[model samples]
Target: MNVMKSTGKFRDESLDFQKKILERSGFGEGTYAPTSLLKTPPNVCLAEARKETESVVIGAIAELLSRTKVKAEEIGIVVTNCCVFNPTPSLSAMVVNHYKLRDNVVSYNLSGMGCSAGLISIELAKQLLQVRPNSYALIVSTENINDGLYFGNNRSMLVSNCLFRMGGAAILLSNLTSDSHRSKYCLKHIVRTHKGSQNHCYNSIIQEEDDDNITGVTLSKNIMSSAGQTLKANISTLGKYVLPFSEQLRFVTNFVAKKLFFKVRVIKSFTPNFMLAFEHFCIHTGGKAVQDEMQKVLGLSDWHMEPSRMTLYRYGNTSSSSVWYELAYCEAQGRVKKGDRIWQIAFGSGFKCNSVVWCALRTIDPTKEKNLWSEFSTHVTN
Candidate 1:
């Protein structure tokens, strides 16, 4: 069981001005913005967004292959995810052409699914490895902010403007027995959960508008609340399947104590220490508030969220690709080691929550490739 991860990122620094974007978008004075929106044109539009996305995907795939010492034609599976850009040619189809991968390779383009698409793509690749041994799977995660930039200055919509930046990540997964000894991590378990809420919850997270003259998509305001509930449920369900017996017993004990003894104080005190179980957490850098909520729920410390926070501050919210940036940060800091455990959590459209857990199979070599964190260390906030 071996896997290699190669990630890529691209941002439109000239388009958005950080300080003005924060104030105009109402993200507050201290809210981090990679670039300001004032510098960017109001009519930049989706066409440009698609072109930038194409560049990142092409560049990322090329970089991944170069680092892995594998040719594009050797890749057996291609999985790409993006929220805003869906062209007639399709992003995956374009990549297939750009890379000239084998004609028989399975390629998929996942759209409309929000940030959680990153983990979902990884899960898809892991499943492929089970059936097709020695196969190579390329997973690319990205988000196009230019398409979703809001002009009305509504706080809810403006949040997207301040938080999202241009970014993408490409990862290479393989089940080759030969690479097992050198690969950094092995995929262990993946849990995906979706919530169905009609009261503008789903509409808030993912919206389709029809105005006769034009049709467009916009994010609703209720996404954070809806996502919080969904994540709690998903974590509980996943815990039942993966938590160690001791932790399970503790949870059960607290429940029983509260029910029988009516000891509300003691029972309510029981919360699973997720961070204690996993050595590292690559939580989606969707926003500062999202990260804070996840940290409080998961019982993680400032250090646990350092990678996520740094990624968010440096790259803004790259949506699906943000988790990979956090993962890369941990690796560059030499935080991951053989047999260490890592947990990746992401929330996206469809009111969806997805999680993936992996264990390092071999030591990571920082010198082997470019690292987003290592390069941005000077600028990242502690």
Candidate 2:
């Protein structure tokens, strides 16, 4: 406190801004933050950063292997994503070393991909499984922003402090025919969109050093606009693959008729009824504002958006892993039926939007599955 006061960094006005952000964040008191960050004078350091990540990442992986009854050696591919914290050895290497995975394991660590990196990792794993027969892939999605908090006076950067909280997930993927019966869901389609070509889009949400030389992720007001535009491009490609022929033809006919009727060269508005393609929606729980914006853009009902909104209020923003938490909420509520098409959508830094579609092989058994939201599931009908 003395050091912060001496430097005239922490001010009374900043407290007001943070307090306002907290009220509208839709984050409950249960949201987890690393103990280091909760300190009066935050004990932010490299060692603490490493400890924070490993605790979440490794613990999640251990629980995954235990529940799945799969040995670490059986994982032929490992993909780990930690957007803000990429160490010298890489997160994948850490998983490899901890699990004592095979020497020939195909491993990768991705950074700077932001919240959408989870779907990117899943997309990569799904593709790899096709070529590498009889193999299993493990993906760990997390954010280690415990030490990345902004202490500077930049309000854009201050948004980061309110938006993110601690969370991680470990997912196992397989391609073996023998494991087919055991697999819960199968990947149907994945669409990735990037708008980084435009300078404004690329700078939508970025990590940089402030004037005080304190580094943090800057989230501009343009983030929602960039996300909405990029998602238009993403679902445009995804629609052809997932939407029924009837829905597709209707959308095109209506779109063209509007343009022709108005004699306008372009139609600035069009959103396919994603409900036609998906039975369940798992939009990323980035924050209250992002969730609210996407809800409007997608024209989703409160029922379809319950998991996302609930996850945000419960777990806060887990970055790349937020979608998984949302999906878990659906499963916990016993809403996933057999043959259900689940749409997982995410918006990230680099002004990227990605969608992963899945089909459940069988009706999920809530008791048999990992019930992350069991406590809330009882009282919450949605």
In terms of lDDT, the best-performing candidate is 2
**Residue ranges of candidate 1 with Cα displaced over 4 Å:** 1-43, 197-200, 210-221, 256-269, 367-369, 377-382
In the range 274-342, model 1's lDDT, one tens digit per residue, is: 865698999988777788888888889999999887777666678898888888888887778888889
Cα TM-score per model: 0.84, 0.95
Ten residues in a row with the worst lDDT in model 2?
1-10
Write candidate 2's Cα lDDT for 1-382 as tens digits.
4234232365677778888999999998888999987676777778889999999999999989888899988999999998889887888998999889999999999998999999999988888888889999999999986666777778898878888899999999998888889887988888999999998899999988888887778988887789878988998899999988887887788777886777665655567888988989999998887778888888899999999989888899999999999888988989988999999999888989999999998888887785678777778976
Model 1 collision count = 13
Q: lDDT, candidate 1, residue 124?
A: 84
Off by over 4 Å in 2: 1-8, 258-268
